[model samples]
Target chain A: MTTTLSLEQEVARLIVEALHLETAPEDIDPEAPLFGDGLGLDSIDALEIALAVSKRYGFQLRSDDERNHRIFASLRALAAHIETHRTA
Target chain B: MPAEPAFPLTARAPGEVLFRRGAEPVTTARFLAEAAGLAARLPAEGPVLNVCADRYLALLGFAAALMRGQVTLLSADRTPQRLAEIAARHGARCALSDTPASLPLPVIAPAAEAGPEAPNPAIPAARIAAIGFTSGSTGEPQPHAKPWGALVAGARAAAARFAVAPGTSIVGTIPAQHMYGFETTLMLPLHGGGAGHAGPVFYPSDIEAALAAVPAPRLLVTTPLQMRALLGTGIALPPLIGVISATAPLDAALAAEAEAAWGAPVREIYGATEAGSIASRHTTREEGWEPYPGVAFTIGEEGASVTVPGLPAPVPLADRLEWCGQGRFRLAGRLTDMVKLAGKRASIAGLTRILTAIEGVEDGVFLAPPDLDRNPRARLAAAVVAPGMDAKAVLAALRERVEPAFLPRPVVMLDALPRDAVGKISRAAIAALAWKR
Candidate 1:
């Protein structure tokens, strides 16, 4: 549980840093959406996050991967996907 | 009377594949049959609001509208307010959508199956096939009507300029509803005799997969923003015959990089919704834009107005152009307050209006700082003076009013905006306030 929480926090920080969000990483709700209504991120931000995740986790997040809707749904989901797919 | 030129200016074999939807090849016969079937069910009168998410469905809706002699309104903005405004303005009777959602107008999902035989209807050249809307400076959408003949002519000109041969698969990263995407991806395949990849290809990996799904001699129709993202990923792409970019200016270095990396020439189209592709340039080799065949640019004391072959009158150009020799010209600068980001355009003044309209927003200003690197991901920033409201609240209000692309990020909260004696916030001042944080 601690490891999962830490990974989610790490992803939150990565997203904040990559997207240059005004809010602090800790302020981001783990369950809230990373796009549209929540953090107001758009498709470009999604690409930016994908690139950042690939660089950090050594895995590619393809938009048409079918799991992308779940992976990018929130910080927790993204962190979990990274946990499973990260080669590094 | 002179005989009216029919649509689909180029002849295509009935068995030739015109579009690739997922793994399925949609032949010319299948496309025409589907369009005819959809056309039979369309409203008898008034224009149609086509908001189909799928590229293939959007094209079918467009062709169906064209067959019925009804103008199709193409807009990427699907907000209820925007749709309502369009419906009110054009008296749109129904909307053609693939997604299951409610809209201001009656929604019609185009699921028309292909019939046994294709219908080769003779569509008049003078028919207003589509009306593309651009976000006006006054916060209203300005409609630019495109005739079928003009679209066909523009597509053929582009095909010739880019050397796009028949059966070449065209993959696009931009939406089919945008003017550039519509012309390059959708219209190009129809009139240019190329096949279009008919799924949403946004992310870099998706673009690669879509390209891999298509056949050889592929042409990529995309904007500089998407191109930048695609290149940034460093993802391996299938061999491309050529790449055509528009909506935003393509930097020479990036163009050269793409040409070198992909081993294909990078071409850019200079056009607007008002005039569907007017000129083309081999970005890596040429600095000046050469007008397409039969298109003439007259530079008068007022400004430059382009005379497209099929348009009724000359349309004034919004960009200041410096004429070289022959039919080539260089873009000087934009003459409007419009800022384009990721192929979506919005006026700064209009954005400011939306910003201030929000309750508890005392004063605000939006600025798109000139990105020296021309980064496709560059976004609009804002500084607002809202006493009791937080940035999230302000943004939430803004989200309802503007498109996601135009939403100003980092809504800076200020005690007061720096205004001069005349109560005007200069561009320099806005830039400083917006970017300083």
Candidate 2:
């Protein structure tokens, strides 16, 4: 048996834990908008997720990075970025 | 009294440090020279929408606007809709932005240069320096214009209140766009002749690093939400001369916690966008606020009104208060039913208007319960009577028009709304509504 899980699931869990969202990790749609209507995350949530990602992984997430909107577009996008950038 | 000095409000001794840009100390001369260069390049007409992310660039943009006789429009709500609204309403001819977006108005970058040295331009006391928009109870962004004299007076009062002497540097977490941020972080440094850190540091580590990088006698200007977040990080902070909290009310406990942790007295400012910084209190020591020097309060049946120096007339405050003698007063509840979430003001009535305005929504109401635990900002719960609308659908519709700060969480759809004979939805009835989400 192989234990293979998607990075989206891992990032979803991280977001839920970091922001203390009411929804469970599995319930969060990977492609659903995380901010302003879908998951209802605000700017504060974005900062918290950024901090958590930097602490959990070994790379700093710059807020002024132009690709921030694209990177944090969805759980799948954020997870993909984390998979490629995470040093730890 | 002696005549006022003709130098620019931000003028300091040549070598005095006024800001730190990534560990490099930026002197007053440097700031003035760069601002003059930028001002020389800017149009001498039209309002400027400053969208500079770096606090220093924002300051330079603001100074250049003042020098060029342009009214600076400061709004933190940078949504395209909000920016478009500002451009339309304020006749904003250009935006000073760091981003490369194509705005309705041309975007001008505040580029640095070694242009011809010119003495800092003199701003008339009557000249309107900047216009700040506050989300009033109407949920519409209302303009509050600050004259150069009023800002200079307010900055002097604040400097005296916070004990920010010349060469004192402040590193703030609040955005430069907000009223308190405008006064303390920018105005205090410029008008009151103190130093400032230009970075918009938000995270705890970033804040700590910014503080560490700056010199001593530093002031940390922030809001309750940001302060709570900073304390939550539990990181050891550098020595701070004082901590200034404004916008939301700073509770005594949080104030004490900050004082104990940071070893600096927490000074809470009581002000609104209408009147910049009116009064301040050392929250750990007392509950009442001492009006800034030359500021007086007249308590009436309606509420408390303030008369500040250099203002034409007294402005009535929305908060109810009683005098404690010697120009000091304690805050009672709000005179009107308005909710202040993270410094932005929105009336419950105004929120209800947006809620019921939804095409599918029939009857709707919103209520704000006092958050004793300091819950996520201010949690506003709503009850709706739309037959087919679910909580998610209602919220989705609301997200399209409403600012994210005012959007109600846990919007419950009920079969019928509890209304009194006069058609008033009582708080008790709203609380009794069952949660649908």
Q: Pick the candidate with the highest DockQ.
A: 1
Model 1 C-alpha lDDT per residue in residues B246-357, reported as the tens digit of each score: 8888999999989888999899998888898999999988989999988999886677899997899999887778888766999877666778765667888999998998
lDDT, candidate 2, at B281: 90
Provide interface RMSD per model, one decimal: 2.7, 3.5
Query: Scoring each candidate complex against the real one, what DockQ results?
Result: 0.47, 0.30
Candidate 2 segments whose C-alpha is farther than 4 A from its true place: A1-7, A10-27, A36-40, A47-62, A65-71, A77-88, B1-7, B372-376, B420-423, B434-437
Model 2 CA lDDT for position B435: 30
At residue B329, candidate 1 shows an lDDT of: 94
Candidate 2, residues B47-144, lDDT tens digits: the string is 99987777888888998888788999998776677777887899998889876766788889887565665566677776778888877666778888
* Model 2: DockQ vs. true structure: 0.30
- What's the true lDDT of residue B199 in model 2? 78
Which one is best on lDDT?
1
Q: Considering the true interface contacts (CA pairs under 8 Å between chains A and B), give the fraction that model 2 also has.
A: 0.12
| Candidate 1 chain B, poorest ten consecutive residues by summed lDDT | B4-13
Task: Check candidate 2 and list the clashing pairs.
Answer: none
